[model samples]
Target: MSETTNVMNSEVVKRLLCYVSYDTQSKDESSEVPSTQKQFDLAKVLKKELEEIGASDVRLSDHCYVYAKIPSNLDKKVPAIGFIAHMDTSPALSGKDIKPQIIQNYDGGVIKLGESGFSMGPNEFPALAELKGKSLITTDGTTLLGADDKAGVAEIMTMAAFFLAHPEVKHGDICIAFTPDEEVGNGVEYFDVPGFGADFAYTVDGGSVGEIEYENFNAANLRVEVQGYGIHPGSAKGKMKNAIRMAMEFEQMLTVFDNPEYTDGYEGFHHLGGIEGDSDHTTMHYIVRDHDAGKLNQKLAEIDKASEYLNFKYGEGSFKVVRTGSYQNMKEMILPHMHLVEYAKEAMRELGLNAKSVPIRGGTDGARLSFMGLPCPNLCTGGANYHGRFEYACIEQMELCVEILKKIVEKYAVKEI
Candidate 1:
């Protein structure tokens, strides 16, 4: 890439491309905090960048969390605001050897990902139609682009750079953090929210340009295990009870209409994440989600009812269900601190962007942080179709996200809660 191209490309895009190069795909079921060691690879880089950008008290923790503080330039005391993003990518897809392709002045047509390979058409992804004439960064079909949170990271970094160059811009203290293993549901498992030193924060992990999320799913993981009597087919009369068959029956008992594919927009889901088993033993995995806590509990109870019925039919110890709470809807927590959300909205509006306050269908680190006394909401990073090969980020939109962050800081400097 020449200096001309570098100047032409947005700083957010450049930072995204650089961050995605380091493979930071987190591992599932790993006992470690980050679940993967390579998450620190990006953490160290972010620490160095923060220091270079004039962010003070920067520290890269042993668990791959990078924390920094930007001192206040203002005289009056105001609420210290924070910004956060995750370091690891989704473990469901490969985040290795990412080769990002830039599409400048995008035409409203089918976009080919690689030569003679996977393609993205406006017809298939109507969102692309809205991005016409914008610069997009996409990956080759083989790997994920990791825009999910890296876009968030770049936007915050861009804000740090802006704050460094322009000290005259008054603001209260700014706290920033980069977390790891967010994809594995342990984003802030060991996070020190009190030590982060922010009255409130925003996780720049939302999708699209003007999105602000305070409501998210009350999430939980469900597992069903089925036990079966293994008997030879020829000798099996009424003794052979196939566990896999039983597991299938249990899954069937759940309403298919409430699943991920069928539901959208504040509608809860009983997503069958995965299922694996044999004739002797089988297990069914699910992620139960709902914006309403009561509804989420009802979904879990329904799963238990299914398991109870199966056990009654197959005898005791034949079936078992396990439910583990992941994260809760942050709406209640955010309500008291609505000014934080308003600041983001005002910031976007100041930049001539229409801010959309939408409920996140999925959970973010901010959701958990809000419950943990941080009252953090989510801000967009200008990316769409995250966690897959088709994931892409709008370069111009991300630059706008950087501006939004700066505006938010300025808003806090002037406005009172």
Candidate 2:
């Protein structure tokens, strides 16, 4: 057996199982740094684990960010590298009381989730076919499996444990951080970039084993409000304008082909995520995304154009649009530092894995951190079908990710600063 395969088969998997048990789902409507206090529960567990593993300077911030470092044992100074992952799971579904089910030696066939009446097969998820004979961790269908990022957390923790256990292994300074509220997009709001003190960083928050991401969507949120004149039906005439009807009209103005269901692979879309309110007033929430900044601006302009036309028809101030910039594509920041990408690919290749550079259709904390001057890219965590109950993580693949991280660390150790 290989040395990588012999390093505690149960360690990474045990850590992952412990992490998903915490209810760390972030809230979007809450106006707080973490957006939810439950994130601190997991943060505290990670902080103690880091200290137990002999990581130096382990600190849990007041805002629920956990930071630590593994000091270099080398005589020469090398570039300090950081690995980051988020603590909070997506609020799209309930994350409370996640009961993860372990399937040993998957048969490359249909598998049923515990009592939740949900089942997955190789036909529906082709990725499962490739993972045959490997142990898989999945949810019970009552709640979402927190593998979206918990798999990442476990991998990093296991890597830290490995390096600390083997004193003979030489490497440079290794920085680690676990941020909160990434699911709600406020992940790096108060992140201490200078304090974390890494020359460059990577977020281990991507799906699949060999995926590497540097490009992401230029994203923005749009809020559309429509004010209508309301009156009793008996007394109502042409003066009574239905706000809900007008809101539907505004939605119809958007191109049908530009919706998420129809677009893929560099295609941009305007997704109407939520809508609320009744006759007198109506509000529609949309997230607009495009890899191209110019195209993103054009989509925003479409919203403005629609609002202007509605206001012209219904009188001034009757229709309004609020656009909020979220995060931009990290491609520009990473292009100047191609070594980060090349080194990651080399590490994966060294592990006999095919490295695939896939653009993130959504965003990660790395997307915002790159613009914040860290030039962060993203790495895979061996999980798939994120943000839903169908999520699962492969044990063997996650262990390989740990090996990949260790190889990258070795590469940077020899690299000239």
Candidate 3:
């Protein structure tokens, strides 16, 4: 592990620790709007912080979203800009009782993660080379650090403090929002775009330090059900059908290369999720994604074709498939507003960082917001290895993220600043 830098002592890291201390993981099976009731724990904290920082019109929605505004100090008209980040962590790992360790001056050596006997070395993660001599905020090998989006939340909150403390910075209306349930694919389901009243927005939820995304996968959910006939062993010769085996067979129908492990960079994929069942019935879930809507449609059609073939072999009514549409590629919505992308690039340039506009393999709240007339794009949070135990974030990079956001506000909030 590296040495903990003084940057780790900044308000951004302090706010992040405060936010992650609460267990705010969203459940996939929950029918609630925010997916989990505990998410409001952090929502209330953020609402109080926003109000304390002199943010105007602060509101915490019943759905657990925190919205606030930093009124423009300038007299002229400038476009209202918004910054957003999610509050809930992923349910894949435990987020309760998180103990974040600060490692200062990483020495490119094996860093011990608590007493769990688990360690992080550059041998396993070559990207650690780039973080040499930097401070890192990591978990204790038992749970995630919640830096996926919490890092983003901290950065936005820090920027709000800066704007309030230094009114001489001179910027127009700055809108900030913190949402929940983004990890469960329902982050902005009830987000009121017009009510937020931002001409353009940015989701500070990307991985790595310099990632800026305008394109994302067109996503859809797939569900397959198998029905089987159960009979006594003595008379099971041809009367018995195993639903488990049918589900496994359906999985084999898809191309092996069209999965997350075998594809990257503009390539589409069909990812199979949890499968549960016995001999009487089986339920399987999948997610199909692609950069092109036409290709995404073809993937869904392929699932239908697989179902038809299974029905042919196992008799009709034996197999069933259903799909629900999720968010689409935001590239279509962002192309008309290239200035948003360019403005972010210019902000990074001002900070001596080259922002790369990469395509998101998964969906983001900004992608959904773009289609909803917000024209939002994604920015980096300086987090790496998200949604798992190995996740960690760079504190120096996070501070730089805060600076980049402040620059964006300074650039677009006024023509001459």
Report clash pairs, candidate 3: 2-104, 2-105, 2-106, 3-103, 3-104, 3-105, 3-106, 4-103, 4-104
For model 3, the superposed segments whose C-alpha errors exceed 4 Å read: 1-5
Clash pairs, candidate 2, are none
Clashes of 3: 9
Candidate 1 lDDT score at position 197: 96
Off by over 4 Å in 2: 1-9
Residue-pair clashes, model 2: 0
**Model 1 pairs whose backbones collide:** none
- The TM-score that candidate 3 achieves is 0.97
lDDT of 2 by residue, 1-417 (tens): 112333335788889989999999999877898899989999999999999989999999999999999999999988899999999999999999998888887889988888989999889999999999888888888889999899999999999999999989989999999999999889999999999989899999998888899999999988898998888878888778888999999999988889999999999999999999887899999999999999999988988898899899889988889875578999999999989999999999988899989999999899899999998999999999989988999888998999988999999999874
RMSD of each: 1.5, 2.7, 1.6
> What is candidate 1's lDDT per residue for 1-417, written digit by digit as tens?
112375356677778989999999999888898899999899999999998888999998888899999999988899999999999999878999998888877887888887628989789899999999877888887889999899999899989888888898888999999999999889999998887999999999988888899999998897778999988999989789999899889889999898899999999999888889889999888999999999999999999899889899999999988775578899999999899888889889888999889999989899888888899999999998888989998888898999999999988899887
Task: Kindly report which residue stretches of model 1 are placed more than 4 angstroms away from their true locations once superposed.
Answer: 1-9
**TM-scores across all candidates?**
0.97, 0.97, 0.97
C-alpha lDDT (0 to 100) for residue 95 of candidate 3: 97
Query: Per-residue lDDT for 1-417 in model 3, tens only?
Result: 343446656899999999999999999967788899999999999999999989999999999989999999988998889999999999999999998888888887887888777888789888888899888888899999999899999999999999999999999899999999999988998897878989899999998777799999999997898998876768889789989988899889988899889999999999997899898899998999999999999888888999999999999999998765577899999999888888889888888887889999999999999989999999998999898878899888999999989999998876532
lDDT preference between candidates 2 and 3, better one: 2
